[model samples]
Target: MKQVEVTLNVNGKDTTLTIPPRMTLVDCLRDELRLTGTHVGCEHGICGACSVFLDDEPIRSCLMFAVQAAGHRITTVEGLLNEDGSLSDLQDSFWECHAMQCGYCTPGMLVASESLLAENPDPSEDDIREAISGNLCRCTGYQQIVEAVQMTAKRRREGAANG
Candidate 1:
């Protein structure tokens, strides 16, 4: 099998990998790099289970090729973990808000919402919903996810103001 060497920054670390041209970003992340947090659902970008942060932006990993993201920065659910391996505040908010059920979609939801909060530290409920529009959650009914984003944004803002 032919492979191409690709270099990218993942979770603040430099990564150089060789993958087949046909391999999707999700495959590379999960299979090659062992970042299994990015799920594979539809594999066609509609399900959003393979969502990840590409250079601080939310992108559907299943829709993109691994080589296409070379030199870019990718953030998976593992990246959301704090230095001590504890959950981030946004992660805690997701739990506090009960933003997920079954938890299959939680990682993608966090990637989307975290990217949204990065762009807009204080996001409205509508903004939160719009940010996660591509990601779907069947069990959470969407309300808790929206509230989670809102709550996270509020917490981030408060922290920024205090710090």
Candidate 2:
């Protein structure tokens, strides 16, 4: 079996790994790096459960190969933590708003929401819906998720104004 070396900057850590060419990024993250936050569902990329950040952009890890991720910055849900290692503002908002159920899609939802918030700090309801369209949540009907993002945005704005 032929193997390839790929280097990925994950969660602010530099990691070099050797793996088979056919291995998917999701596999490398979960199997090798032990970042299980990125789930695997609908391996065809429709479920959006395996979403991760490639250079701050939400991408489906299951649809991408490990080799293709080389030299890229990957951020799994584990990376979304405050300096004190507690939940981030967005994560806290999710909890406060009860944005998760079963927790399978939470990670992907977080990634998608983070991407949206990064690009648009003050996202409208429609914007929040469109941002999470790719990630499927059969649990909360998505209303709570949208509310979570909205809450996070509001809190962030307040914090910025006060700080």
Candidate 3:
């Protein structure tokens, strides 16, 4: 097997690693960088469990090769935190709303929800549903997830208005 060096800007940090060309982005993030918040589910792109942000856009890490991610920004689930190391508003809302049951899909859910909220701060229920439709969750019946996103949006709006 041949090894290639690639630098990935993840979580606002740049990390260079020597890896095989065929290694998936998720594997590189977890195995090499040790950022385990991004889970590996189906290995296929359909599960959405391996979702992450590629240049602030939601993408399936499992479907991309590590070498292919070179020179691009990758934000894993662990990156979606406050600079003070506290949970982000969306994460806190997920916890408050009990949006996760098994936790396997929470990371992807957070990524999807965060991306949606970034584009549409005050998303309606239908908008929320459409945004998160790509990620599947067996627990919480998705209602809590939707509510969590709604809570985060409302809080952000209130914070902006109060300022």
Q: Give the per-residue Cα lDDT of candidate 3 at 103.
A: 96
For candidate 2, the per-residue lDDT at 145 reads: 89
* Ranking, lDDT, top scorer first: 3, 2, 1
Candidate 1 residue-wise lDDT at 87 = 95
After superposition, the stretches of candidate 1 with alpha carbons farther than 4 Å from their true spots are none
TM-score of each: 0.92, 0.96, 0.97
Give every collision pair in model 3. none
lDDT by residue for model 1 (10-92), tens: 89998888889999999998999998988999899787888998888889999999999887888899999999999999999
**Number of the candidate with higher lDDT, 1 or 3:** 3
- Candidate 1 vs 2: which has more TM-score: 2
**Residue clash pairs of candidate 1:** none
lDDT (C-alpha, whole model) for all candidates: 0.88, 0.91, 0.93
lDDT of 3 by residue, 40-60 (tens): 988988878889999999999
Model 2 regions lying over 4 Å from their true place: none
Instruction: Tell me the deviation in Å of residue 107 in model 1.
Output: 1.1
Candidate 1 residue-wise lDDT at 136: 82
Model 3, residue 50: displacement in angstroms? 0.8
